[model samples]
Target: MTVFILVSGVFTGAHVWEDAAARLAAAGAEVHAVALTGLGGPRDAAGAGIDLDTHIGDVLAVIDSVGVAAGREIVLVGHDYGIHPVLGAADRRAERIARIVYLDAGMPQDGVPALAAVLDQSLRARLAERAGAGGAGGLGGVEGADGELPPPARDEWQRWGSTAGVPEAALDRLTALASPQPLATLLQPLRLTGAAAAVPTTGVLCNGNGASIEMVQLRVGVGDPALQALTDPRVTFFELPTGHWPMLSCPAELAEVLLRAAAGEGHRLEPAGAAEPPVHLRPFLLDVPEVPRERAGNVDLYLPDAEGPWPAVVFVHGGPLPAEARPTPRDWPTFMGYARYAAGQGVVGVTLDHRLHDVADYERAAADVAAAVELVRADPRVDADRVALWFFSGGGPITADWLGAPPSWLRCLAATYPILAPLPNWGMVGSRFHPAAAVAEARALPIVLTRAGLEMPEIAATVEEFLAAAKDCGADVEVVDVPHGRHGFETLDPTDESREAVHHAMRSVLAHLTA
Candidate 1:
């Protein structure tokens, strides 16, 4: 018999698992949902002394009460903020645990606190700043009176995770049952002795919250060491189509998934082989000759052989790329390929290194791009009056700056496989980076967009939204579609269609620049 121990995330407690627990019980598995020290009760009852260790004790107590002996196996399931305590307890009780399930939660590394896993970028930044400035034991100041962080307001619940597929009554119940979370739980780092590392693990990704098996695979394929670790044979994945709160939104499905996870039955991610280069470093599809290049600050200018004051195209690479990513975007084969290809076609191709290392660094990255453009135009070999800015991937949002107010010298704007709107999980509060909303201001400036047919659903939805907004405003936008192409198709899916799409996009941008 398998005994499943459940842990709820911040704001809720064991009660949050009632529906799922009943379903699991009916399926013949023993279920025990843990309500941590300071949660699932009145806010006043949660004392100031409650901390992460207290919650760890709470989980440990449950583990001790449910004896893992006599042919009984234990499967530990942690949801959201609950993963921190779950990991802590699992680390101590490694020998008794059969498997650990990370349900819509981040993989908490040793010495990293739960705060690092907070989904809200701005809030996380603020909290970190406060913690560094002597807030509360390096945790940060809490909004609640008794050293606890208050639960999100009803309308603002989306800040925590996506609410899609959750019924209205369930949401009301969730809000009502929400409890203040102890600040120390989020501040204190999780310590491990490497005991639980060998335990088989399962990840239940919530697709509605913008995490999926495909995204994980894509991240691993890029050679991210942290994510690459998940490719281990012992680690498996299962995706839920509902929102973050699967218990409230789809209890029966969640119960089934939990049961399968207990059985170690799920899809496995393929490890990135050491022999092959990462997707970004792969050879460019187009075999264009290398052009003469000169470095100016962080920007690289690829000059056409016959250039004497020629039109230029500034290619901006997409990111929120890992800070440790090698070769940088400027040195990546795709950017190099595009630059070289443009130079071969008689235009100066410009590529620059920007500081968009995190989602919040868009402003800084836009500044870097603007500064690079100014430097490029000042070059004697480039025509200052006719210039185009071509963006890719996550860099697409930076186009909002230019689209809202086009300069006379700016000839065209282009984006390929771009994220035109903030993803649901991004927690972007304002419309500052929303290109779809800004397209209305782009009256005469020519726009070129290249879309991949097999792009990620969330990203593709943004592109569709942008296209609709562009059409509504009658903006002069030309879309180039690659029917069977995926994101980063230039190198990842090097087919005839990909090549043609790349050429068509380049031709369109060049035409606008020369016109």
Candidate 2:
């Protein structure tokens, strides 16, 4: 028999796992759902002193009480913020833990606080700013004098995680039962002794909340060292079709998946060996002549040979790129190729490096882009009044700023395999970065969008949603479809369709710039 210990996320307690716990118990497993200190209880039960160590102690108590029996194994399951305590406990009892399951949660590193796992960008930013300035008092200020953060209102629950597929009744119950979370819990850094790395791990990705097996594979394929470690045989993945709160939305399925995870049965990601460069790092697909290059601060300019003041196309690279990504986006072959290719077609091509290293850095990235554009326009070799912006991948969201109110000098906009909407797991709705909603204001600005047919479903969905919104608003948009292409197809797929789509998109943008 296997003993299962469940830990719920912020603002809730063991009560949130009632349905899943019962299901697991019915399947002949001994299940224990831990109610961490200051959560999943009445308001008065929480106090200012309850921090992460308090929650870790709660889980440790449960583990100790549920002593190991003959032929018995223990599986620890942590959901969302619950993973902090689970990891903390497991680090101390690595030999006792048979496996650890991460349910729709980030893989937190030692010395990093749970604040990094928060999906609400604005909230995280505010709290981080406070933490940096006030030291211990900084986070306390945001949580109120009581040092406890109140549970979100019923309507605001989506800020915590995706609410898709959750029943109305369950949501109501969750809201009513929610407890205030101690502020210190999120502020306290998680300390781990390296011993827990040996424990087998299972990641339960919730696809509806933006994480999926494909996404993980995509990151790994990009040669990300952090994600590459997941290729280890000890780490496996299982995806849930429902939202973040799977226990409430699909208890039976959650139970089944939990069982499978405990048994170490799940999909394994293949290693994108370090021998060869990742596809994005590969040489550009186009064979255009190299153009004269000039660096102006963070911006790189590829100038046309026979130009006095050429119309410039500023190509913005997509990412929440790894902070440590080698060569940076401006130096990446695709961007360099696009810049040079644009110069070949009698235009100045601009590529820039922005601080979009994390999802929350969109504002900073946008500012960087704006400053870069100002610098590019001021250059004597570029025609300031005939500039176009072309965005790719995650950089697509920044287009929203220009779309809502295009400047007279902005000739056109282009996007390739872009993410037009805020991803479900980003914990954002009606955000300023949502380009799908902003497309309506781009009435006269000609827009060129390149789409990949075989793109990841999550990303493809955003493109489709944007197209639909554009159609509804009657925006002047042209679609260039690559039927046999994938996201980052310029280098990943390298098919004739990919090459033709790239050429078509560039031509369309150039025409708009010249018109």
Candidate 3:
């Protein structure tokens, strides 16, 4: 695999991405750090003539220089100002591209210029004033200085603390190599076709600035075209804790994230674990006709050592592993762990693999869940009337059918850090995945909802709206608050908080069945 690391322009160089590039290369990926025209090295003098097209050509040239062919897949990663040119290049060569990653960068759709898409009026005016003052031909410094903007001074560095989490030494090198950005590049509009839309994309959001996907969605509704493409079904989202300059501040973490993205992993909000199942339940596999059209995997059953006619819970995983992953049973360690935990509680725990090619597959995956529920019910070992659906992150929407009019067999529904909304490419267009809609479709069945304290704004908003609607309808729902938690915190980083949340979720599931 090859990853072309595109650096932000306006005084930035390939050196800025050195750590990330090195790490990616170490992970067996062919890495190329492209320096746009007049942006790095002594070529800063030639930046006056560099336009948007010039930088676009620079990316294409680098692709050619790297000798990427049709057979080998390549991942294109763009950071900050680099998003535009990379998109332009990706538009021209989307066929050979495997995935495109926007690292805390603008996501401009066709016809929108990168700068106009991301910059607010205040930031625009600041850049303009800085560019005009600088005699270095329409290039501005970070601090809005005139004439070949110098390295960031003490105050400027302080201001960048949240955005650039690099150490002092790295920051020094950054300013030392900082060059000038071409004004034309910012003004240039990008042209693209439907081809680029087909490429799977990931947005590595840097939460250091307090920006979240929920905020991005709000911006999209108010005529901000920059985040427009992110609303698409094919684009997945991830978050990093560092500031804007993750390459310098959190290179190792960034690299690991990119590797997972390239391999079609981490699409889920959190990471899976490798914990072994409890000793009481033994794992057994039952053969079933494979579902047609890919995304069909094994169904493992965890039966308690105690007795028959036990309550059952079907565990559905999130992260919808990409097609490129060639996933095996091992890919879902977190869900398997959950199944084991449930089995340890004397319940029949089931972990299933369903088709999740994209968000639109929610309906298909739901069908699979129904099938699994039927299979579990038919088994003499499980209680036919005591079963529930347990969904996580990407699998949250699969509960739509159950939520609308639950069957007599399903005792309750349990969802943990679920994306229970019709956002982007994860669910069917008219599906009842929206919490408000699901809650409105009244049913007597009980429900358990868990919310992360440090939840992503999008999920947080959905949860609040759901709870409000549930309360208004007087639905039988239990709300569990995981204070000091995050989205998918259970799997990403196992802590006392996550453990407590899981226990609460299980408790809620049990309370309904026993009641």
Where in model 1 is the C-alpha error above 4 Å? 42-45, 137-144
Give a tens-digit lDDT track for model 2, residues 391-448.
9999999999999999999999999999998888786666799999999999799999
Better of 1 and 3 by TM-score: 1
Clashes of each: 0, 0, 9
**Ranked by lDDT, top first:** 2, 1, 3
| Model 2 vs. true fold: TM | 0.93
- Scored by lDDT, model 3 comes in at 0.67
TM-scores of the models, in the order given: 0.93, 0.93, 0.49
Model 2 alpha-carbon drift over 4 Å, by segment: 42-44, 128-145, 221-225, 272-275, 427-431
Computed on alpha carbons, the lDDT of every model, listed in order, comes to: 0.87, 0.88, 0.67
Residues 280-324, candidate 3: write the lDDT tens digits. Answer: 122322111221111224567787767678898888776444544
Model 3 residue 236 CA deviation (Å) reads: 1.6
